[model samples]
Target: MAEQPTRAWYATLRHLWLDERDARRAVPPALAERLRERVAASERRHSGQLRICVEGGLPPSYLWRHLRWRVPMPKLVHQRALMLFSRLHVWDTEHNNGVLIYLLLAERRIELVADRAVARRVDAQAWSALVRDLGEALHHGRFEQGLLQAVDGVTELLAPHFRPADDGPRPNELPDEPVLR
Candidate 1:
C-alpha cells in the first residue's frame, strides 16, 4: 500500500499554496504604512523610483507554479516578482533606475528587481546581500524594520548613479507608496 501524505506536508502546502485574494490580509496595516512611508522618503533622496511590494500569495498561473504533491502548481516568490516588475511598470522611468522590492509573505521570500539603468551600475551581489539581510529580518517577524533597511539600502546604492540635478526639482516619475497584492 502507498503511504499517504503526512499532516505536516499538508500544513506546509497550505502555507505556501494559498491563492485567495485575501492573501493580502497577512500583512498588517501598520507594517504596510511603515513601508509606504519609507519608500516615500527614499524616493525623495534619489532620482530612481523605489517601490516595495508585499504579496500574500501568487495567483494561479503557468508562470507561478511549483511541483508539489503530484502536481505542478504554486509559483516561487522570485518568479512572481519578475512578472510584477513589468506588470507594475517599474521600468517606466526616465533614467531606467526603478527598483522593485518584492516580498512573498507565505514563503517569506524576497526578490529585488532593478531596472537596467541601475542594474548596470550596481552588481547582482549587492542586491543579493540586501535581500538576504532583509530576509533574515522578515524571517524574525521584523516586517517594519526589514522594509526600512531595504529602502535605506536602495537609497544608498542609487544615490550615486541617480542623483537629482542641482538646478531644478525633478518630477517624481513614479508613485511613492508601496503596493500590496
Candidate 2:
C-alpha cells in the first residue's frame, strides 16, 4: 500500500493547536523535519508571511456567540482592538518592502500584500539568508524565535516613538490655577 500524502504546514499547525490527538499522532517526524527545513529555506525567499491577529479572537467571537446564545463580555469582546488597529496602521509602513502574509485561521484564509520598494532593496541573497535562518530556527521547534527576529528587524527599520513619562508630575501634585481678571 502507498503512503498518504503529507498534510500542509498550516493544517498541521492547526491540528496541533486544536489538540487533535489523531492528527498529532499521524504527524511523522519526517514532516516535522521538513517543516524545519522549509523554515530554514525561507531565508532565501524574498517574501514572508507576517501573520497578525487578536489573540483572544481565536475560535472567533461570532462562533462563540452562536454557541453561547449571547454576546461575550466587553473585556473579552475587545481585548485586542488596539493591537489589531496598530497592526494595520503602525506596522504597515510604505518604506518597508516585502510581502505581507495575513493568515486568518477563523476565516480560513491567507492574504498576500506586497511592498515593491522593499522587495527591490532586499536582493535574493539577503532574502535567502533570512529563509535559511528561519528554517534552522523552525527545525529546532522555535517558531516564536523566528517571529521575534522578523519583528525585530521591522521594528529597527521603523523606529517608532513612545510617549515619555512626565518626571515632574504627580496627579495630586499640581499647583492651583490663579483666577483671571
TM-score of 1: 0.81
lDDT (0-100) at residue 9 of candidate 2? Answer: 31
User: Highest TM-score among the candidates is held by which one?
Assistant: 1
67-146: candidate 2 lDDT, tens digit per residue: 34434333332333333424454235333333332323222332223345545544555445554564465467564465
Model 1, 4-69: lDDT tens digits are 335434534655576434335645677667777877777777789888777766554422234243
How displaced is residue 135 in candidate 2, in Å?
A: 2.5
Evaluate residue 104 in candidate 1 and report its C-alpha lDDT on the 0 to 100 scale.
70
- lDDT of all predictions: 0.75, 0.35
Worst 10 residues of 2 by lDDT: 172-181
Query: For candidate 1, which ten residues in a row score worst on lDDT?
Result: 63-72
